[model samples]
Target: MQQTYQTLNALTNFYGAMTAAESARRGYIFLGSSQDLQRYYNAKADMRSQLQILQKQIHPDESQEKRLVSLNLLVNQRLSLLEQSIELYQKDKTALLIQNNITVSSVQIREKILKVIADIKAEEQTYLQDSLEQSKQSIYFRVFIEIFTTFLILIIILGLCMILENQWIKRERIRDLESSLAQEKKIGDLKIQLFSMISHEFRTPLSIILLSAQLLKESLENLVDRQQLKNIFRIQSSAKIMNHILTDILILTRAEAGQLDFKLQVINLENFCLNLVEDLQLFATTANMLRFQKIGSIFKANIDERLLYSILSNLLLNAIKYSNNETEIYLILKSEADMITFQVIDQGIGIPLAEQHKIYEPFYRCQNVENIAGTGLGLAVVKKCIELHQGEIIVESKVGTGTTFTIMIPQENT
Candidate 1:
């Protein structure tokens, strides 16, 4: 009876250690902390040693020994599987660092790990229940033999009750944690939906304001004095800037919702780019500062005009905005065998190398550009547009030197 109690105590301690290790593993996986991982490994090794010692010390009947061996093997198998998953997670994290690629596969793998953890917890509960049942049977048999020992029986009962209560509290904590995680996920999803709806709803009013500004500019052109004309120009520019912001928001909303429609039509590449530059030049403070150059023989290609316009206009506007009036902005177009590459170069306050990676994220702006007027969604919108056209955009920049945006898109053969 004493040996049985000793074995049960060791098993309980081993289970506690396993639970601690699992928690540490979860922390390492989600929070990416090496310290937690180290703790987990330490606990795992301790658990293995403790279980080995207990297995050798507790030599019960044939049936009970078989049960103990089976339980030990089950735990070892689960721990080994968990170790593999942790190793895989480490590899995935390393790959993410090296490649700078955020793929859905990582999320899927995390879900798999979470599921495995859940399974392990369930198995632990089952094992604990089986052990408890066995212990109860042994205790009841001992109580039947020693019916006169009422105080000892009461103490044993109280201990069993305390252990069951501890198990209940632990299970409740796990349930609460799962609930909180689910709730957070739901909130995140709702935020995206809300952002999309708000952005979509804003376009109508922005379009009206832009139209009114254009009409006011046309009506005052001949009647107003030079100063008034300048005021009107400022109003028009402000309205245009607001309109661009709204367009970016709308495009981002559409992109997020996977609703961006592409209407492909043949367009004259050189003339298309020239007209775009001409349109943007109105917003420029200096005359002849924005230049367009075509490197190769440009031909008509099937392209979505609106998306292409959005891409070029945003890049050109950014170049103009970030640079001084005296600084020249270059828009270079190169037509390849099956692709068209566009480059927008500007002698602007360039982005830092560390910040360049985050520029494409929605509403992310460079620290230097905070004082400058921008919605910070221009590059994000440009990236989305390029992605829709199966294109790639790369940036080259040095602080106080200059910045260049290179975009390459496949020419649709139609």
Candidate 2:
């Protein structure tokens, strides 16, 4: 009973020390900013006036912050030292109680006190990490505000310049200014829409992957069955989907900004398409949904192998995703006079007439098919990739009929 009482007292002291340390650290952080320091002093004086009332519930020990002000140790060491001091104080208090015949000596009390100190350090480390994360969030918020403010300022300057020019010049300038502003607004809206779509689409699937992996890791004993392997395959499929979305965003941004770099080489188009089809077959829900409609003859193309692969892969993946569960997705390659045309035809819910024009706009989902899953940037990336290769994409679709995307690229130079 005596030993238990000592342990309780030690725990109480430890908590009190931690609370005091936290209060002091907050006080110091407050001092770092003039506005916060002013508030702190006002609050401190009010507390000082109510000390008698506060003392009823608070400890009489001096604040840990004040005691460690002169120490030169790192933050972790300071916290550990404070905990050690509290442990010593608890031991002395316990010893005094024993001397007065109020309690008895406890075995291994020192070891227990040290263990408590270690636990306190662990908790403090956790607190420190949380604080760092909060600081980072604050910094990011400030940067976003600053960037938006700069954009507004530029828009205002452009408006003023348009108002002050000569009559004829003013008309032309205003037209250009309005056009630029409209373009900027479109870009901003698309970015916001894209970010929102990405956040929602990626979070659920990524979380599933993580949760499934964690479960398998924790209990492999009874989970070594066909079901477990199927679960693992599910995670792999989700990861591939995420990778495709990320690749689309990257290639789209690079192409839009005219920064896309390519290494041209001769690649066997037939073998390339075959390999791609094989790799993507695993991602298909059924074998029939994914197929390669072979070209009339083996054809070769001189192009960036990586870019071409990404373009075809993105197109094929989207066909599989947007098509009906059992519908066929065809990958047809045909060589004409001086170009090769690749067609991805899907017999799924067709694009609406109203949204057909906006299909290639970044993050612009068709109104009729918003229920389907997509980042809405897939087709935009496909268009950019085709344009970069001096190619063109033609879309033919009818509502409730189906859609076919035809991409034509110039044949490789001999």
lDDT of each: 0.71, 0.59
lDDT of 2 at 332: 90
Q: Per model, how many backbone clashes are there? A: 0, 0
Candidate 1 per-residue lDDT, tens place, 211-302, comes to 44544444444456767778556755765675677667767767766767788888878879888988888789787989999888755677
Which lDDT tens digits does candidate 2 get at residues 1-414?
222223334435544543444344344342344443444345434433332222333222344223222111232343444334334434563433333221111113324434544443334334434444445455445534543554465467447545543443444555677776665555545544554455455555455554444334323423366555675566567666765766677677666655667778877688788889988987787866777876666476777888888878887887777777778888898965478889988887788877788888999888767576777888888778777789988888887778888988987547
Per TM-score, the best of the predicted structures is 1
State residue 239's C-alpha deviation in candidate 1, in Å.
1.6
Model 1's alpha-carbon lDDT is: 0.71
Total residue pair clashes for candidate 2: 0
What are the models' TM-scores?
0.51, 0.48
RMSD per candidate (Å) reads 31.8, 23.2
